[model samples]
Target chain A: SAVISQKPSRDICQRGTSLTIQCQVDSQVTMMFWYRQQPGQSLTLIATANQGSEATYESGFVIDKFPISRPNLTFSTLTVSNMSPEDSSIYLCSVDTPPAGVYNEQFFGPGTRLTVL
Target chain B: GIQVEQSPPDLILQEGANSTLRCNFSDSVNNLQWFHQNPWGQLINLFYIPSGTKQNGRLSATTVATERYSLLYISSSQTTDSGVYFCAPTPKAAGNKLTFGGGTRVLVKP
Candidate 1:
């Protein structure tokens, strides 16, 4: 099992303010993913951050809204820029164990719950 | 993009009862995983069964890659099992990215 932690278990911010969520892992991982969960909704993939490369974002999400920084294997940060009340959601960082066979066990951080007032 | 659908969006179970959750995928997948989100919002990995069957404690999962569906069995369910259960499937041609299903919300009353 991988130990993952995210800063700011939760926060309440005014609209238009930006917030950066930090994710730290106990060991080196090649792929780190960011996900979002709106109130009463399932998880949605935001982007994939890999060391030494630009992040790849999924549809309906853009870098201008969520910029990711993967400085190294064990650290990554996600910035929710120009926040709005609609951006209020739980942001989670996930990493999968090195591919062993066809199974890559994925683990999630505690998640940063943000509420824009 | 692959589509994932889980049955019984909401489930209510009594303690010590047995329940099964199902996940259906629209495309062939190279990987499938199950996750549990607790009331505190902590997501925990329950199984990484891409194919075949695997069991741990009172929980077990089986993924039939050929059939494009999976099943999760909870035997003797406990109150702790009350939460949201999610299934993520990765398309065969896609990288390690996971597309999560809407999830099944389970409520276990003791």
Candidate 2:
């Protein structure tokens, strides 16, 4: 299992501001993902961050609104640009564990709870 | 894109009771995992059963790849188990992206 941690466990931000969340993993991984869990909603994949490459975002998300940076194998950052009340949600970072035999699990970070007002 | 669904959107169980959570997918997947989200919104990986069954302490999970469904069992439930449970599956054709289910909210009473 991989240990992942996110900064700013909880934060309150004013509308129109941006928040950059940092994700750090204990071990090097090939794939790191960003996710958003909105109020009363399921977790949605925001993007897939690969080292030395541009992150592949999902259908409803874009690089402009949610820009991502993957500087290395063990670290990445997700910046939620132009925050709004609707953008308030818990952001999480996860790493795809190296395949151990037949099992490869994705471990999640503690998550950053952002409240925009 | 594969669609995932979890049954019994909300469940109320007393301490020491046992319960089952189900996750059904629209297509065959190469990876399936169960996760528990505590009240504080921390996601804890429970199992990574793509196919077959596996158990760990009070929780067990079974995933039938052919059937495109999985089941999670929690026994001797405690108040600490009160939280939301989610299942995510990655389709064979979908690279590393995982599609998550809506999740089942469990409330354990003392």
* Model 2 Cα lDDT, one tens digit per residue, B1-110: 78899998999999999999999999978799899999999998899888999999999999999989999999999999999999999888886577899999999999
- Provide a comma-separated list of chain B TM-scores, one per candidate: 0.98, 0.98
Candidate 2, which segments miss by more than 4 Å at Cα? Answer: A99-103
Evaluated on CA atoms against the true complex, candidate 1 attains a DockQ of: 0.72
Give candidate 1's TM-score: 0.97
Q: Over the stretch A51-88, how does candidate 1's per-residue lDDT look in tens digits? A: 88889998999999999999998999999999999999
The fraction of correct interface contacts reproduced by each prediction comes to 0.77, 0.77
- Steric collisions counted per model: 0, 0
lDDT of 1 by residue, B14-105 (tens): 99999999999999887899999999999989998889999999999999999999999999999989999999998887777888999999
Which runs of model 1 end up more than 4 angstroms from their true locations? A99-103
Which candidate comes out best when scored by DockQ? 1
Clashing pairs in 2: none
TM-score of chain A, model number 1: 0.95
